[model samples]
Target: MCIPPEAQWKRATIPDRRSVPFFGQGRGLTDSQSLDSIPPPPSPKLRRAQKVAEQKAQRIQDFKQRCGPGFSSSSAWQARPWQHRIAIEQGIRKQDALPEEMEVVEDPTIEEPVGINPVQVEVGEFEEPTVDVEEIVAENPCQNYHCKHGKVCELDENNTPMCVCQDPSSCPASTAVFEKVCGTDNKTYDTSCHFFATKCTLEGTKKGHKLHLDYIGPCKFIPECLDTELSEFPLRMRDWLKNVLVTLYERDEDNNLLTEKQKLRVKKIHENEKRLEAGDHTVELLTRDFEKNYNMYIFPVHWQFGQLDQHPVDGYLSHTELAPLRAPLIPMEHCTTRFFETCDLDNDKYIALEEWGNCFGIKEKDIDKDLVI
Candidate 1:
């Protein structure tokens, strides 16, 4: 019935929870000790190497699967295992060895390793290599060439780039027949491309130089332009030019067809209350309006000439340069050919600025080179 002192003392000293071990103790350890006991995570270099090895192994397995059992019997595949082993050993040595421990020696007596053949060399045994300039030029000679207008460069049998007539089919398709044109020979072409291509085909002949784009639309019975009509041409043309610039200014709110410089010059004509609007006008109306607003017509006429004289800018309008304006007008305006023919005062095949102004009735004293803009 009496409790022993030793048992009472033992009960009092004993704890209710389990005991945690001290550092470096058996069975139970501290957090730091536990972390230290665990193996350190692999180094970044080692992890990367392992990943690469795994990828290589996977690729090899995939190749084997695709090639089947017969693949292993092939010479390349048979030699692969040895190659892989050698590669792995070399990689390990590279990673583990110090820079000083690595040595490279030229062994002339040793047999050449697999997949490598040695080239024997002796002093002053070199020969100068011959180069074929023609072969080099043949590779892409067309890249250095530029063909004339309406023509194209083509490679011949000798791989030389030569100017040739462009295929008519290569020209863009016309959306409407209204885009068709008539040549001087009274033949109707599908588009300007057909006409130019035909001209290019006749390059060396006298007929080629004579051939010209006559008019817009198609061939029709064009009455001969009389001298009286030629005299009246400038009056109508000046009025038309002024009206064109004014109309362009009015519609140019959203469309930026006119440059800032062009718009500034056109603004004066746009605001002129007395200026005649575009329409079918009599020669009397054209001449009277031009006289009333002569200054307004001058700039637009000069501007048009400048725009057309772009290809060679030598103050002369070439046939190609005049095509845009002249071709379209010839069919509609009966006086077009005669007016232009008269503009070439010297019959030099080019329309000089002075001659152009004279054709438009600009006074000799008022004709200025600065107004070409």
Candidate 2:
């Protein structure tokens, strides 16, 4: 069933991984196995988890002993044990300079109870409410089960949450032109949702495997890239990357377009008043500017690689990972495939950071691992 984003995001508890018991040969002990014969947890991962849980329980017990039996810590306190940290964060911590009104949850009073979770706080008193496990489960049966882009979670005949392919018609109509995307099939989709939902229907097919979101906008005719033009593709791309950074710097807005580290790096480029402005300069002009301001292009090359090398993040980008950069450029630059294929150099079907850096004309020495940020 299709659900609105606001409704789908409703907060409710669902079953967690901890509740499920691991069952496998030589993993979990059999019920018939005698207590003495039982092995030290076969799974090192499970043993680590148990050790961590035991340490937490011991710490909580030690804390209760230190604070006295009457002192009952809230659930949040039991979870994090950070009454002073919470108080300091919420600006209610009592210091020698501050008054009693600025008291931390560690020093609670009957007159003014201050702690985490307002639901647990009953006006002037704090009490943990009796929870109805069934009721919470009913409200959020699908909470733990997240579906992919074109699917939604719904209870099946057995009342178990399962992700189903969403109907393309259920997708909301695009309000702007840019929302319409072109797929690798050279057909324009109403929106990304329409494309993904349609693609989901064709799952496990030869067509589906080849299909991908080609670009951000509708399909348009792009002239074939010749051998000579293909050679100059990198020149134009490097220039574009540098100019994109400069444009973003000039329009300095902290809408999370770039991280603080990225901002600091771009700030240096922005300070250089001699940097090229945003425009459709000729390839010859672009090449000349790249030679004149070579340093400005290096980080942008690394930055683009970092942006795409995120799925598994092993310092290597697979074909799927490169899709975001490649798919968009394919419709505009016909040399997109040839250029990337050339970058692989070894034809390993994966592009490393070094390969990506070299493709952009960055010197072998300048392509440092430290610049990947």
Candidate 3:
């Protein structure tokens, strides 16, 4: 049968389904209808890239799962309506279609709760923080230290604090020569401060340790002590000490220098007219007066020792500790050195209370430590 002209023309113009451009237009069509059929097998490089992409996606999913609801990779996509529409179009349908316009309108019917309960998190009790011992030691390492008067604290290589004699130059300057003192070495210092500072600088040396402040004034010719004078020295010194205390008691109306306990003790001696006043008495008069007022002499010697033994209070006199009493006496009294040297009966460097009392001619029974006021 011959086909009609209109039907023939229509059939000729219609393209074959296989020949028409489809999703995989460049690739030849086959009977298969799956995504694998649409595209050919990728190159080795592309396959490797695809594998890497799949692994990255899997890692992201695992990270989200581990983090729970606290983490989300698609938060930005979810926040944007345009992104959400694009994602939906790409994932659900690949056709060009206009997205439905969405208007966000607040719903008045959805009311907030009138009174919501606040989240009450149960907290554990707080504990005091513990400090490290090293940290405590490191903090103000120089604190709680003891150094000599003219010395300072310093840290060593191991970060340990130590005492070192201060530089003499660091000491404050003397305003006048009135403050000057002379050393036994015949050296005159600008001030007592300068003398002590120089002495500190010479610490641990033989000459320095032996050196001492000789007098209040500059150095002068001090006569050598004779044997007779040395024997009489203690008598004069005892008398001097008693007189000094009496003088202090008489003048201590303000209660500034002597304590009330000390004043009470000295008051008895002050009232005693039999007590010899401080004067240049003959040796016979001194000896007679001391024999009569033996009790008066005991307290002064003990008091002097107590004053000198203060730095460590070990009941012994160190050379430096004896400076205040010994220094001034050394220049004025020629027998001072011989007297003190004889006092150390045991030949020990320090002078014990017993030795000191014995040297002053106090009887053994009367040489009481209790008298050290």
Using TM-score as the measure, the top candidate is 1
Predicted candidate 3 versus true structure: per-residue lDDT over 1-373, tens digit per residue: 3233223322432232221122322232222332232333344432543443344456555665666656554443235445323332343232123253468888777544445735443344446678767634446677878877667889999999998877777767778765778887889888776787788888899988877777777777878889999889988898998899888888888998788878878888888889886788889999999999888787888887888998778889976787788877876787887788888888888899999889999989987887786
Candidate 2 structure quality by residue, lDDT tens digits, 5-39: 11221111011223112233224333343223433
Ten contiguous residues with the weakest lDDT in model 2: 5-14
Residue 32 in model 1: shift from native, Å? 49
lDDT at residue 322 of model 2 (Cα atoms): 89
What's the best-to-worst order under TM-score?
Answer: 1, 3, 2
Q: Which stretches of candidate 2 lie over 4 Å from their true place?
A: 1-141, 156-161, 174-177, 253-255, 327-331, 346-349
Residue 52 CA displacement from its true place in model 1, Å: 67
Tell me the deviation in Å of residue 1 in model 3.
Answer: 99
True-structure lDDT of candidate 2? 0.70
Total backbone clashes of candidate 3, pairs 3 or more residues apart or in separate chains: 0
Misplaced by over 4 Å in model 3 are 1-146, 154-161
Q: Lowest-scoring 10 consecutive residues by lDDT in candidate 1?
A: 16-25
Winner on lDDT between 1 and 3 is 1
Give the TM-score comparing model 2 with the true structure, all chains together: 0.55
Name model 1 segments beyond 4 Å from true.
Answer: 1-146, 155-162, 169-175
